[model samples]
Structures are given as C-alpha cells and as structure tokens.
Target chain A: NAGVTQTPKFRILKIGQSMTLQCTQDMNHNYMYWYRQDPGMGLKLIYYSVGAGITDKGEVPNGYNVSRSTTEDFPLRLELAAPSQTSVYFCASSTGQGYNEQFFGPGTRLTVL
Target chain B: AQSVAQPEDQVNVAEGNPLTVKCTYSVSGNPYLFWYVQYPNRGLQFLLKYITGDNLVKGSYGFEAEFNKSQTSFHLKKPSALVSDSALYFCAVYYGQNFVFGPGTRLSVLP
Candidate 1:
C-alpha cells in the first residue's frame, strides 16, 4: 500500500544549500512526522503535523521547517543545510487515535558537507 | 516530559538462546510502550507494543515485551534468537501527541 514514501533517498549538499525532503502516505492518516536518526542517538523528532494545515515543532526543529498542505503529504525544508544536519531522515504517519502505531518510510540519507 | 532509555548499548547471544533487550521509560500518565527493529540501512520496523490491557504483549517475529509498571520498564524478549533477529532495537513511549524514542540497543545473534 506504500504506507509512507520519502524522496531523494540519498543526497549530498554543501553547507548553506537548501533542499526539501518530500514525504507522502497513502494510508489516509492524519498524523505525520519527521525524524532524523544519528549513530547511537536513536531518532530525534524534527517536526510534525496532526493534519493538513497544522504543523508543530518537535524536539529538534531548529534547522528545519515543515508544512502539511494535504492529508497525504508533509514536506520538510532545510533553509540552510549545515554539517550538523547530516543524518538519515525518516517520515512517519499514524492513524492519529488510540494506540497510534506509526509507519515509517525508508528514509532520506543526507550528507551536509 | 516523557523519556525512554535502553540501558545496554549492545547485546550478544547464541542462536536458539533466549534474548532480552532492556528498556525503561518515565512518564506522568499511563505509558504506551513500543519496540521497533532496524536492520542495516533500513527504517525502524514495528515489533511490538504495550498499551493498557495486558502486561505481556506479543508481537511479530515471535517477540514479546513485558510492561512492568512498578519498575517503569518494558523489556523486549524472545524465547529463541535467530541470526536474522540481529539488529538495532528501539524503545519508545507515546505522550502528548509525540513519541519519544530511546538511544537504541544493538543485538547480535551468533549462529
């Protein structure tokens, strides 16, 4: 069902460059999230949206921004990529109720040089 | 605030042996615990979870986790380990419209 999909599986960007990580889900879920995984650091939430037109900051949202224009899509924007932003980015979605088990994407691996 | 911890950085076990990955969490409300496995270069895959009903929750791949409310621990366990079971394991707690994940534990099942 392609529960969740993320684009640009791998990308290399120089410091100060800007880019967007695209995420989409076909599960009709209302809750979407962005997270970055670093070695030994587990997953850190970047941004999240409860539904279309609603976005909120997460634990580590300083260098990133997110928007949810439609129920199926939530895109993260890096206005000024920095070396500190280098990590594997994952997009996840959930049903937004009850237990709220999330389904994740394959992840977009970005290297900020 | 809610927090989760996986005390062990890594765990090793012989194939067919019982294996356990430790995790503990802190939260003011009822804890919704979860376990996810990630293979090399892959995304975290849901393994099991504990909500409200039962303390012993069974999940995919013959894995289960016991939620100990008194200890604030939800440790993942499997009766028999397999080489394929070797991966990175994460423990998470659902709270306040967000999920907090642990630092993760690496599991190595030797044949």
Candidate 2:
C-alpha cells in the first residue's frame, strides 16, 4: 500500500497568495492529520479529521483550513500565505484505534516570499 | 494538557558505544508514549511505543526504550551504536485526543 501521499513536494508562494495542499492515503485510515515542521522545532498540528466530512482544528490551526471530503483525502487550504507559514508540511494517517501509530507522508516544503 | 520534553538538543556518541536519548512526559492518566526517527529529508518512522506491559520495549533497528513510571520518562537506548543510527529522534505523548511531540533530539553517531 502507498501509506500516505502528498502533492507538490515543494512550492514557493508570494505574500497574500493562496494555495491548497493535497493529501491522500490508501490504507483506508479513519484518522488523518496535517502538521508543519519548522527549523529547530517539532511538528505543530494544524488540523485533523476523524472521518469523511468531519474535521477539527489542532494546536496551530490559525492561517489554515482543512476539508475531508472522502476517507482517503484531506486537503489543507491557505487563504493568505505569509513568511511565518514557510515550513515543511507533512500529512499523516492512522487507524485511530487504541491510539495507533501514525504513518507520515514525504512532506511538502513551502517557501513564502 | 499532555506534553513531551527532550532535554537535549543534540547527542553525540562514538560508533560501537552505548547511547541514550532522554525523554520525559507529563500526563494526567495512563501515558501512551511513542518514539519516532527521522532521517534527513524524510518523514518520521515509528520506532516503538509504550501502551502498557513491560517497562522495557524493543523496537526496530536494534533500538529500545524504557518507561519509568515514577520519573515519567521514556528514554531510547542502544547497546552498540552504529553510524547509520544517526538521525533526529522525537518523543510523543497521546493525550486529550491529540499527540504532543517534543522539540526533537538529534543523534550523531561518529564513526
């Protein structure tokens, strides 16, 4: 199985520009998550979904939005890009049973200029 | 709120020497802890997890972690370190329906 996959491995956006980051999982996971990693810092959860059509904000949900249309897809939307949003974004999925371990994607590096 | 802490920013060890990476957690109830390793330019890979049972839990790549209930610590250890073991390690705790990760500790196994 392809575990988890993300699109546009790298991207550069200008101030006020908007973009969407796509993520998909083939493992039929019930839980999906979006996180950002900054240099010398741990990952910060932006948003998460327990199932299709159900989503919630995470620790750092500001400046980001997410929609889970299908069990396999969860996309993150950035309405207005800022330099602070410049970081490596990762998508992960899990079965959400008994606090299962998460499977992470390769991640997308975003640079906002 | 649950949290994780990796006191050291970087740890250096010589090849073939025993190594340890410290992690301490703060949780109100039963603590569910985990360890993940990340190589350069790659996503995190699960190393081991402490759900319950033995205090000593073994994981992939000859790695193991010990859960100390009293100290609230889960430290990763290896009997003999190898150059390939060098990577960034993170400790995480699951609480309140979310996972809180530590700042991460970089391990440098000098050959």
Candidate 3:
C-alpha cells in the first residue's frame, strides 16, 4: 500500500506565485505534518494537523498555510512564494501523536526565482 | 525548548569498517529518540526509534542506535559499513508535544 503520496515532485515558481503541495495518506493515520528541508539545516515543521478540520502552526509557518479537510489528505499552500521559501518539502503521517514513528512521502522539490 | 544536535557534519569510513554517527539531545523529562536516513534526492526514512524499551534499539538496514540517558545521547552505529550506506543521517528528539531534528551528518563509505 502507498503509505504517503505527494504530488508535483518538482516545481519552479516565480516570485509572488502561489502553489499548493498536495499530500495524501492511505494508512488512515490521524496525524499529518508539513516540513521543509534546506541545504544545511534540518527539517523544519511548517504545519501540522492532528485530525480532520484541525490544524496548527509549526516552527516555521509564516509563508505557508495548511488545511486538513479529511483524514486522508492535508495540503500546504504557499500564498506568495519567495526565494527564502525555496526548499524540498516533505509530508508525513503517523497513527498517533507524541513521538510515534512517522512515515514520510517522497518529497516535493520547489524552486522559486 | 527541546533540541537535537549532531556534532559531526560528516563522517567517513571504509567498507566493512564499523561506523558511528554521534548525536546528542536536550529535553525535559523523558525523550523519544529517532534516527532517519536520506538519500541524494529522497525523503527521510525511519531507521529506528527509542521509545521506552532497551537502551540499544535495532532497526532497518542493519542500523542500530544506543540511548544513553546520562549523556543525553543517541548515537547511530553500524557493525560493518557498506558503500550503499553512504547517505545523510539525522537524529531527532521528541519532547513536550513536538519533534525537533538535528542538523544532520553525512556519512560516506568508500570501497
């Protein structure tokens, strides 16, 4: 079974452009998260949702937004892409919260110019 | 605040040699530790985790990590390194309600 699937494996956007990174999980996990990975820095959480209709800000959530309409999908939206927002984005899900092992998707590489 | 640290930016080893990737953490109360590996253009994959079991935890890809409470460290180790094992490794700690990852260390195994 495909645990987690992310769309638009790669994308290039002009400054101020908007886009959404789609994420879906077939494991029926209750927890989902969005994270960005930079060159030297580790993964930084952007947004997360514990369940459907519930979402929360992560450490670095300024340029992004997220919505969890159903347990299977949680998408992250970048309202206005900036050079600083160019990074590889990853989507992850877990069956429960609090330290549980998370399954990550292949990842979406976004470049802003 | 909870945080994780990988003191080494890179680690080099020859094939068949034992390898160690250092990791340390700081968090209040109990901590949930994890190790993940990433290839050149792929996402992070769970290697192993220490929840509340034995201090030494073994995971996929013949990788293992030891949890040392006194040292606040969870170092990943492999008995014998393989060329295919070359990749980036990350250490993470879960405290309070969130997981914080370390900067990551690159491991290169030469044949």
- All DockQ scores: 0.69, 0.70, 0.80
Question: In CAPRI terms, where does candidate 2 land?
Answer: medium
Give candidate 1's fnat, 2 decimals.
Answer: 0.57
Could you tell me the fnat of model 2?
0.54
lDDT of 2 at B12: 100
Off by over 4 Å in 2: none
Candidate ranking (DockQ, best to worst): 3, 2, 1
Q: For candidate 1, report its TM-score.
A: 0.97
> Per-residue lDDT tens digits of candidate 3, residues B9-49?
99999999999999999997889999999998887899999
lDDT of 1 by residue, A19-112 (tens): 9999999999999999999988989999989899999998999989888899999999999999999999999998985267889999999999
Model 3, native contacts kept? 0.70
- The top-ranked prediction according to DockQ is 3
Cα lDDT tens digits, model 2, A50-89, are 9999999999999999999899999999999999999999
A1-113 in candidate 3: lDDT tens per residue? 98999999999999999999999999999999999999879999989899999999989999899999899999999999999999999999998976788999999999999
Clashing pairs for predicted structure model 1, backbone only: none
